[model samples]
Target: MRRGASRDKPGARVVQPPVVYVHGLGSASTVYHAHVAADPRLATRRQLFVDLPGHGISDRPSGFRYTLEDHADALAAALDAAGAVGADIAGHSMGGAVAIVLAARRPDLVSRLVLTEANLDPNPVPKAGSSGIASYNEDAFVRGGSFAAVLERVDPLWAATMRLADPLALHRTAVGLVRGTRPTMRHLLMSLPIDRTYLVGDVDNDLPGRAELAASGVRVEVVPNAGHNIMFDNPQAFINAVAGEAPRVTADAYKS
Candidate 1:
């Protein structure tokens, strides 16, 4: 749990609430280590890294639905386990979406939010013969060998994790991601009472909606020379962005 600057030091500044880092699909808490370790601001603040249910070392309950809200609920429980009242949250991709839902559904558990390339639309692009999650072929994906290839290139550790993850849990979560719930990502981002920031990689061409988000008054930051996986491509830049030290840019350039 709690790690950062010692509170016993004389004249210690007021302690900032913990910052919880949530990883995206097929990713583990280790993805945030580089950025967290290098960020000086986090040295004095509590940092919590969550391994969402069905991913990493977390348990994979057979009855779980793995919906965005489900993931949020699990995260809320994790916070309770940590004895944290509320925390600043930084989430990437699927994790970002989960954070949005958490901030909307359980405002008491979130103080601030940092969403990096979170899915904003309820309907995701078609994949594997379906425009939504309804048609996802989990067994085929796992058995076809494509998932393995993708994981191997992205991160061998992730590949290993995938091999062990509950197939149903992973499939259901993926489906839930594509078929977002009633309070969609867009609504959650716009309505949450807490402070919200959106960060994207310069090369994340898939995120064409950042401009719209910026127009809505949300602060947006871009990590240069990076892609969808900002932390993996430019960990230092991600840390800088999270620390509010990264240079700001108008979202006009990212408009579709």
Candidate 2:
């Protein structure tokens, strides 16, 4: 499912640089197809949908570590393999954290960044730990088989991939996401020397730090009438947000 920009079209003018899209945990790159299709600019621009190690069609080697650093390194390697240098990056949820790390560690590989509801702080949230950093419950996945069972109903291919994914890799990656090492997402985002934007669904009430991010002058866009999964809930809004256009009011009671 790896696709790069088409260079064969004669006289084609590319206004924007290539973009690399990274999906969140438990999801594959296919999650972004709708948003890509909805936006004409993105459809024409060179785009790469990256599947993190053990998540999508990528190989799951025995000794590969799935830490945030490892994921960032893998993403960098993937971009290099595709000969994509200085490409814009967009990531959702856990993928956002990975994109932030990539921008911080390998600035040469990323030009601009668009992060949708990225986990800024991996600390525990309220509500019985049902969301935020606590949401990646490896115990529940292992004991209840919820990951496989739920995905089977929603996405059979993802379910099949989950069955083959290395449990240790999944567990370690989840743990690493919560207990991030030094130069955490916070530090990385604040220090990264590139243009970056933070986007979140307007209905996402559980976001860890909205006020602080706003106060810090980080550009934040709230898609109207959308939740955590902005792409699925409101594909047009997601596309508009990424394209730096004003959110289209598809619903009443638009929240700021």
RMSD of each: 5.2, 5.7
Model 2 C-alpha lDDT per residue in residues 72-93, reported as the tens digit of each score: 8888888887777898787887
Candidate 1 lDDT by residue in tens digits, 1-256: 2111111111125467676788777666655443564356656666777878887777877777788888988888787767666677888888898888988878888888877777777667664211332354776654665455444654465565556555566777878888887867877797776767887777845665677776665777776888777777787777765665666566675565
Prediction 1 TM-score vs. true: 0.81
lDDT of each: 0.69, 0.66
Candidate 1 residues lying further than 4 Å off, grouped into runs, are 1-14, 127-135, 138-161, 247-256
Model 1 error, position 211 (Å): 3.0
At residue 121, candidate 1 shows an lDDT of 75
Error of 2 at 180 (Å): 1.7
Clashes of each: 3, 0
